[model samples]
Target: MCSCQQHSGTANSTSAPKDAISFRVEDMTCGHCAGTIKKAIEGQLPGSAVTADPASKLVSVVGAADFSAIKSIVTGAGYTPSPDRVS
Candidate 1:
């Protein structure tokens, strides 16, 4: 089943996120999709770190990347980034 649960790495974690964005990516169906999103995010924002998991449908990013820019990159990469949680 596809999971749309929010990625809480930015909010619930004890350590502050290196970048301030974490949210649910509902379209990740496999490792390839996860990698594509990760590469796209990192490419768009050089020096950024991205960890995307297809199993959890979660993406955690740590960098200076803008949220809107990230969303655009994800959309451009044929994926859907739904809902921004905890800023």
Candidate 2:
């Protein structure tokens, strides 16, 4: 299912400017998967903050990378980017 859920938060040092976009990954299945996705995103966008909840199959990414690029990173890390959860 493809869906976009918007979240609001402050900009910390780990995140980009206030206008930076965030994406919710709904396909992450485990800690290792989360780690891989996090690494991939961070590798592409340094200091990117990724938080994953395996129980909810949800992953939140805060960085400067565009949605498409972030989706690619997740896919490259071997996880499917849920169309319903990417912002």
Candidate 3:
């Protein structure tokens, strides 16, 4: 798995609500894209359960984390989340 250390903030680092969420990602087109997005999320949330499916362009995250933080890491991984942001 690829290691992304540029952004390694704990999900608890924020006071915002932490819960599981499923949202569409606009640019997850391949396995590599899914893996990259997964890694990016894990990099920050550590124990967070992140499931990214290239076929569906949806990423499901279960654990602690703020929406902005999650979005930032996803974008940094070279993917754009859907316009809806969260689903």
1-87: candidate 2 lDDT, tens digit per residue: 212233322222333334555455556555555566667788888877766655456566665547778777778777787765433
Best by TM-score: 1
Q: Rank the candidates by lDDT, best first.
A: 1, 3, 2
lDDT of 1 by residue, 18-64 (tens): 45577677888766777778888998899888877676777777885
Task: Look at candidate 3 and tell me the lDDT of residue 72.
Answer: 80
Per-residue lDDT of 1-87 in model 3, one digit per residue for the tens?
A: 233434332222111124667678766766666777888899888878787766566787888457778888887877887655453
Which structure is stronger by lDDT: 2 or 3? 3
Instruction: Report residue 71 deviation for candidate 3 (angstroms).
Output: 0.3
- Candidate No. with top lDDT: 1
Local distance difference test scores for all models: 0.71, 0.59, 0.67
Evaluated at residue 55, the lDDT of candidate 3 is 57
Kindly report which residue stretches of model 2 are placed more than 4 angstroms away from their true locations once superposed: 1-27
